[model samples]
Target: MSDAPEDLDAWVVTLADTLGLGADEHPIGLLLDLTRDAAHGVTRPAGPLTTYLVGLAVAQGMTVEDAAARTRATIAEWKTEPSEPA
Candidate 1:
């Protein structure tokens, strides 16, 4: 296995191909930004949970791009709202 960290995209593509999933159709940068927004604007666990919801939406026949767009919009709205102190 290659030890280069820059090869993460290649590794992700390979894993997606192995699983017969369509990762190449989506923009990695956008996904990362959405995840970052979810984590920071909402909560740490929200990042993965948001992504998981996007996946579920896609599985239910929504386009991946649309799901990402919706998730980002939701995060934007979350950022505008005030959060209660933990």
Candidate 2:
């Protein structure tokens, strides 16, 4: 229900801080912004596109190990290259 973009941004920043990810510069800040968008219902249809998914999951009360595993699975799905059956 927190769809306001500004609120999303703030939430993301605070999350980054809580995780010690520190959204004060490039890369990390951008990723945090992306996570905020996800929480606000924005999504990349193909799948999770960044570590933001991991961070956001952690922020959502998921256990660290569970979030890490889910994040890894999402990343693997995104990175899987199409293969031709030999």
TM-score for each predicted model, relative to the true structure? 0.72, 0.35
Q: Flag clash pairs in model 2.
A: none
RMSD of each: 3.9, 9.5
* Candidate 1 Cα outliers beyond 4 Å, as residue runs: 1-6, 82-86
Give the candidate number with the greatest lDDT: 1
Candidate 2 C-alpha lDDT tens digits along 34-69: 454443333454234445456566668986567655
Best by TM-score: 1
lDDT of 1 by residue, 1-86 (tens): 78564586788788788889866654667667778889998989999888878878988999878998888877787789855657
